[model samples]
Target: MKPVFFLREALRALKRNAIPSFAAMATVLVTVLVLGVFIPVVQATTGAANEVRGKVIADVYLKTDAQQKDVDRVERVLKSEPMIKSVEFISKDAAYKTERERNPKAYELLGSNPLPDTFRITPGNPDDIAKIKDALAPEAAGGGRTVIDPAIDEVRNREEDTNKILAVTGVVKITMALLAGLLGVASMLLIANTIRLSLYARRREVEVMKLVGATDWFIRWPFVLEGVIVGLVGGVLAIALLAVVKIAVVDPLAADFALIAAPDTIDFPLLIGLLLVAAVAVSSLGSGLSLRKFLRV
Candidate 1:
């Protein structure tokens, strides 16, 4: 049978089962929102942790009384090293001011600046950090310079801690994805069952059509279309609810976590593609389920 006749019959079926159709749509919408919020939190925290690990830098402190020319000489040599990515000089005065700004109460009690001049050096990798430490130990050991091996070790320890956090988040992310997938499949089954029941209720009329010189295909198409229509509505509602969650909940968290990859959640193109795919899949499943009662096979 052609689609025009089936389309009219499908609309009539939907009008008759409006309450069940609405229930299925509402369930699908709630599922989308749960998955939407789950995705971004996993993305942002993971992104921020990686950014920190990829940008580790070590500080090399010097005696407060160290000469400017001596500091410049060391800076020039460090810059020439192959493994070093960058070297920045931090003067004692600058360090003092930074501390004061960071902790005003402690700064208020201080009589004089306590921080030493330092070099913040970023190396190419973990191995490069080891090489720089070996090369600098001899010079930092002598008469007046305030060696910074302790401070560099602290930075390495912090990187280790970041790695631990990443591992835990990875586990949590896996757990959430599995949970969401199960929930999605359950929602699909619920929608299919809803359409199946509606089809069963109208089986008498469908049998009459089949008996009155109607072909099997002609009698079956309308029930399948009815299922597809319900499925499509559920898919549309799911997409709309996902958009609301992204704007209302994810956007505000993203603002405060800008350093953590501001656009952490699903992008528009991906979200749209997912929505269309979900709609088609839902409709296909619903059609298959609902048509079982109408078709002899």
Candidate 2:
């Protein structure tokens, strides 16, 4: 059959079964909406977590009495280490300035600057943070008293912070995957059921066409096209709803939630397009599956 013939027949079927068609479209809308909203959120959260993870650094704080020369020597050695990606030296004055800028109120109660000079070491790999921290540990200078390297006081790896971020990201991903899978299965089953009902309403007509020598594909294309149309429409509606929520709810409250990563991580338009395509594909698949038993006629 020609394309126009298929289109007309699909439209006719849609008109004849408007209620079921609407039901299928509504199901698609809800399922796709759940998918569209959560997927981006999970992507953004993981991206932000990775960004912060990449910044994980081991801070080597120096004693107040340590000599500048010794500190410089330690920094040079740290830079040459294969496991360390980079090392930045922050002087005591700079550290104090940073603390003051970050929390001015806390400094007001103190009489003088108590911050120490430090070397910020970025590890070559996040998993190797502990190794890098151990390698940079201050050496025992002498007797049983065990004094550290002349220039070092303490080393803080921020291990707890890093682990927490990773753990949270992992949980978010697993939860999102489970939710997406459940909704996807529900959507497919609902679409299939609706398609079956629509097809059953016209089973007698299908039998007549089959007896009159109509090919299986020739009889199948219209129903399949009808389903595709329903799915595409539903997808479009879901996307519109998502856009509204983003603008009205998310965008407005974004400033209050500073921890959320930038939205640039995922391309909104591309994501929406993919969702629309998925909706159509699933709808087509559901329609084909539902028509299997009727095709035996």
lDDT of each: 0.64, 0.80
Candidate 1 C-alpha lDDT tens digits along 1-297: 568878998787678777765665565555555545555555555555445545556667666667777677777777887788888888888988888999988988986898788788877763356556656653444553333333322222234654555466556657666876786677667656665665677778777776787877676677667655655666666667777766897568667775434524567668656765675567656765566667663
Please count the clashing residue pairs in each candidate, in the order shown.
Answer: 0, 0
Candidate 1 residue pairs that clash:
none
- Alpha-carbon error at 29 in model 1, in Å? 3.4
Model 2: residues with Cα > 4 Å off, grouped in runs: 51-55, 60-119, 123-128, 131-156, 200-207, 255-265
Q: Quote the positional error of residue 280 for candidate 1 in Å.
A: 3.9
Judging by TM-score against the true structure, name the best candidate. 2
| lDDT minimum window of 10 residues, candidate 1 | 148-157
